[model samples]
Target: MDVPADDDPFEAQRERASNPMRRLFDEYGRERSGTFAVGVAASVFARVLDLLPPLMLGIAVDAIFLNESEFSLPLVPDRWLPTDPETQFWLVVGIVLFSFLGGAVLHWFRNWGWNRFAQYVQHAIRTDTYDAMQRLNMTFFADKQTGEMMSVLSNDVNRLERFLNDGLNSAFRLGVMVVGIAALLFWMNWQLAIVALLPVPLIALFTYQFVKTIQPKYADVRSTVGQVNSRLENNLGGIQVIKTSNTESYEADRVEEVSGDYFDANWGAIETRIKFFPGLRVLAGLGFALTFTIGGLWVFRGEGPWLFTGTLRPGEFVTFILYSQRFIWPMAQFGQIINMYQRAYASAARVFGLMDEDAGIEERPDAAELVVDDGRVDYDDVTFGYGDETILDGVSFTAEGGDTVALVGPTGAGKSTALKLLLRMYDVDDGAIRVDGQDVRDVTLASLRDTIGYVSQETFLFYGTVRENITYGAFEASDEDVVAAAKAAEAHEFVTNLPDGYDTMVGERGVKLSGGQRQRLAIARAMLRDPDILILDEATSDVDTETEMLIQRSLDRLTADRTTFVIAHRLSTVKDADQIVVLDDGEVVERGSHEDLLATDGLYASLWSVQAGEIDDLPAEFVERATDRGARAETDGATTDQ
Candidate 1:
């Protein structure tokens, strides 16, 4: 099936900008009031400690060149240290040890605070995204593929995790390091500091240019990942079909095409990384060289005004150069961070897009609980459609409690569509459907669904034991209740015959079970729910004749004392219904008791004759009674003659 392109230009733009990395700072800023503030505090402390080494080096320079000058106090500037070299040496040693210990403590707290903040933010975003996924309506699922959804939940979310764990923390540490080093350099000699930072603006410009160039490539990579995921999902889902049709080569080729696209995308990103990282490294190297050459010349000549002022010294120059190199490392890393941010931004946009989808169907503010009193259902002039194509016209029907109404129609005749409406899978476009005198649209979805048991033609069972699948809906059901429901659905015998009895694993979607067995398990599941209303949609169409008979018997017992709605292609199934509805082209053409509809000799009668193999094949005694009723009706002139 060809997927339709999303037509909204705004939606396309939103998708393009959904990268996780682009929004990292926004994500962090949102938490700035709490843990982020703590992180900032710790980072400030860490940066303050980082400046100590350069200041200590400056003190050592003063101590060596002017021994008494280093020991001067604020109030007594002329006071000198003791003449004994040993006393001054021990004092300097004590100061050095204290500074080292302070730096260590600050470093520990900084790391602890920043890491905790990242974890908290990651948790919040992940929870919010997952919650949004759950709240999204069925239409979202209909439009998006399952594999794409999985990618958002798993891969995209994990990218954000990586950003938090490494990217954000790394950027924070680097920023602190750069600011601390810049402050130390300014304190040592403002002129030298200016020279060292001359290349910074150019480096920033290069970093921005590199990010701009790589953003599109990373976006392409993200798209390619989605495509590859979608292909894998399709192939895995249809593996059985491919094998049966001997289309392995065709499927493999398709997978390769998608995989190749992903490879090309990554290759482009790699090229960008290669070019940008090496260029940034060279720029950083040049900055380091310039800092060394200029600072060294100033120190050797001792003629630079800042050095002559006694504010700057030889050892201080050396330490400032070392600190400048430290600043350059983070400058180099800025390019890598930009790369990570762009990729993360691409992923974040996709995840946020999913999070932003509005559920088309939602409970009204005044929605009430479903009151299942005898399960009476009334469809009042209902109309529904998918997009522009109407699947059901202004159809109306009423089914009393304990009545079994069967809908017989050709494919696409709105039989299943009507059931979907009754189940509230989709709300009617025009009119309202009422259950127990309450409008379905005005009932809480959970209460409404709990009151109806629906069994579709395709039975879906989770990977679990027979008992678990059967008791899925009513988890608190007792062993006795489970056994009784299974027995009522004619599933207990087969289940007990399995190797593990009720504990036997069903595999994915009950692939371990035969078609009949899966259907029976589904029936048992619905039976356990014991809902007031039951919907059986083509319940026995896929089973063999023998299995159908067994299932029919089980269904007869299951439908008793409940409002049952059955959609079937075989007219025989509807023959015993209290009222049979024949639909065509989204309109109900005929409706009445079996005998009355057969007597009418209309669409329903024609379909019944064909399905029953002959008009006479329907019980001979019943046919005779129907003929007598028809003759009386004709004589009375109260009804039209067939």
Candidate 2:
């Protein structure tokens, strides 16, 4: 659970989830066990059958061609063997052909089984990982980049598929080949078999070194991929700003820097890997060369040779050479297997780490569906903070059913944060927010959120038709209802004027539409929700004066019978509220009707005076408030720059 310092990125990142590959199998592989078993079984069967051809060829060479040894197979009974040499020859040919045909069939099954297993696991992991990610609290995403998560879902997952398909397949096939071939080699002649296997221990030592050295390098490479992706996504999303500011060269330089980091990290891993694979081939070639030289001398002398003393037949010597090559080939391929495994393990570590992120919004086991009777909302001494900075503290207010209460405040007065708590966006550090005497935390999140509608200052619209964005949450809304909601938000006129009307493509983030058009659509979507409580956070702040009046009229109808909490900087929007709560620095500064607050000559009255074009009549207290806000802005700007 410990996070490393920024200076230590990969060494600790690789260790974030220890034995992640094992955990991955335990979590996702059990369900695909049947396919996995099939792949492994087919690979074992195919490799075993493949070894039979070389053994049969050796037998035919000696018994039929040279006639130096009798015709026999190790497992077959001697009586089953034909006395006719020509018949034995045909039998060898038949067995070799069957081995090829049978091995071919098994290899086909192996490929199918592995593909199914890898694809199934890939699909399930991606969907499940994404589900977990989306359900995590907003604070998790606030600290994460969209591209980093995309890398996990795309690049990291595809690496796992390759490892599972290629790595696991080669591992199983080579394993069986090495074991079956080694057993046959020693059976023919133990002394020459020893020379063939001498390189195995060296191969194993080199493989271990390769894995140890390449693991962190691969981890570094994976991290750099995420950074590069993050940089690209950030730049592309803000391409407008870059173009307007003419910062193309600056942004390109930043991209090149991150891309260079990726190249460096990848080349480091490639350097280690390329060196290891060739070293393995060398060891394999060494073992094959040693086996051929020793076996040839023994065959030439027709007697024992030095430390290796044995009677080696031309045919048996040929078989030993063939089996030794097979044995060493698998040993050589072990390098590739280890290389793939290290990459997969690094990717798996990142994936499992993401899955293991704590889901901050958890429903209590005994939580029940929320039922709104009167839509009465109460903020009773509610307090919340992020770390040491309290956004809202000891803020208490009440809006009885059918009340429209406006929250007016300075920029950092916690106006929006206070309303968000009513939706249970974050749990209160202390005290509670209740609706109809039910604690927001004690109700199911879905049911609680279903009873509330929100229209934020910053509107979000997915790339879709005008109708699709309206019915986003209300997916089953009829055509009539969609039109009525759009009419209610004053969006019908602009939408109908568009080329495609209801079917128009909004483009990414609704970029094709103007800000006013997007905000009106957001209001329409909220109207379709038809919740017991409504939140309007600067809903009319972005529209023109004419559009604002039109939307304001619609909002009056929208908030008529519902309990509405409006956060607005424009004092005109809330001049007719049932009650106006003015806040300053995370605390309530005033609460009253607009006319009554103006009579008090406090912060609300001052903010109203400035917005009302009463600049010459600004009170001394208003000037002080402006000075404090300016100071806060500067401090925040400095922190952002750092």
Candidate 3:
């Protein structure tokens, strides 16, 4: 099978981005760009105004204790201010109250903008990821587990939202505080500012080292989360099987084993994260202590005429002390910001990576819709494979309009592969499959599938009422039409006898019903579709003999006016096919009617004899092949013995 890049959903993109997290933001954040800018601007203004209160307090101390001789405003000259000391104190107090009020208003705007932006991005990513997954070919799904995909869509995507809302907002808030405080401190006294900022470079280097070490550990943690989810999902889905096998303890041990692996992986990352914060606090503490000691000595000097000729007034020293105390938190918050970004980066790789995968089966831009008048299908020298192992080679066959063709072969003989080709589930490596002279690959996938109805050996029904399951493909079908299809499939009588009749809920995969009942509902679903081409891959194989006969009657009606292909193991099911094509090892080994091939005494004859319990009359070579195929099918759990 030609797998998609999403076989590993975290595969690198073709045009590798230097920063994937930034790319993700640009892609989904374009719609909310105005709101995002507003949020950031509000946070910046709030931090700037928040610094005003400390400056006002320092000025108030100078006016009250040192009097008008030492008190002097830079912007407001002595002529504009009140001469009384008490009036000056009240004027400064009012300005401080106004600053606090402005900060509160800006903080409100910041919360609204960031919260709305986070919600919109989360919804967009989840929907876009699901849409991409649905467009991929079946081979991609076969290579992945359901739980692994769910983990990316649910858990990983949610992580991105948390970072954008809380982490990114906090980062910007702390950034503004750090920058604003630094400028104010330097203006107060450059010498004291140097002491306060001395530890900043060291903190940055320490955070850089922590980020580099924790990144790979977080990647490992994400991978282990997927494994644990897969194991739990698999066990829950097959709980009935485990109970019947009496392996509850065995399954419990397996769950514990994966859970323990997740714990160890998470704990390893936790150890690295826990060590980072305390070390950051120590650096922040050093900056605080150094600034306090140096500024106190300068305050005692009264003018700093002796200490390097840089004079620091007592009021300015008070301002520097208050501002330096506020700087420590932003430095510590910077470390947390790095931790959140690393987590968001890993999740972005998986979510955006899935969205970047190429579709294996893509339609040409100019491909036209399929026009099926009589629904004739032809496989002209078709050859295909999964990886390097060929499944169908030089396989040629034809089914004329309104003809029934049956395919019979042993296990893994490419019987089902041939039917799937006509549906364009997997394109042929060579040659072509056509509907009414139009190549399948050349036609629109939707129109081609719309004209064909398929019922597989493994019947699957969704978790819904009988009416919903029957009308799944034909969503706009009327109640009368649904009843008509159910009656034709011989399912109406039993469906009406259930607890809620047609409204009864079928558990997941129709587990609430027996195999035969689920099989009948599947046929009803196909019958309601009413397509021009029908493919039945052992459609009645799951039912009992009596139910099979009932379904066979319905199949005859459904295939009366359509080109139908049947894949069967029981020779009795396809004895009346217009053409019978027998395959062995991906090649068309026998081609003829039932009676003509039986008279030829070839491989088809031997298979028919074995199913009919006439093995003694088979030739040595034919009997030996049949015996080998039967033993292999039994070991592989393939139901080909019948």
The number of the candidate with the highest lDDT is: 2
Worst 10 residues of 1 by lDDT: 1-10
**Residue runs of model 1 more than 4 Å from their true location after superposition:** 1-38, 54-58, 61-124, 305-312, 605-642
Q: Considering every candidate listed, which one attains the maximal TM-score?
A: 2
Q: Check candidate 1 and list the clashing pairs.
A: 18-348, 18-349, 19-345, 19-346, 19-349, 20-344, 20-345, 20-348, 21-344, 21-345
Candidate ranking (lDDT, best to worst): 2, 3, 1
Model 3 error, position 448 (Å): 1.1
Q: Which window of ten consecutive residues has the lowest lDDT sum in model 2?
A: 1-10
Model 3 over residues 466-513: C-alpha lDDT tens digits?
Answer: 899999989999999999999999899999999999999998999999
- Give the TM-score of each candidate: 0.85, 0.95, 0.91
- Model 2 misplaced stretches (Cα beyond 4 Å): 1-18, 616-625, 638-642
Q: What ordering of candidates by TM-score runs from best to worst?
A: 2, 3, 1
Model 1 C-alpha lDDT per residue in residues 1-642, reported as the tens digit of each score: 111234221145346454444465575547644666666676676666666655655556666555624443223344455555566556556756777788788767766766676667667767887898877665566656666667667777778767765776678778888887887678667887887888799899998888888877776776667778888998898889999999999999999987887798789889879998888878888888988887777767765644334445576676777788888878999888777777677777776676666666779999988998888999888898779878789888889999999987655668887887777777889988999889988999999999999998888999999999999989999999999999999999999999999999999888899999999989999999999999998889899999999899889999999999988878787789998888766888888898999899776776677676776555565466456756755775652111
lDDT of each: 0.77, 0.88, 0.85
Clashing pairs in 2: none
Better of 2 and 3 by lDDT: 2
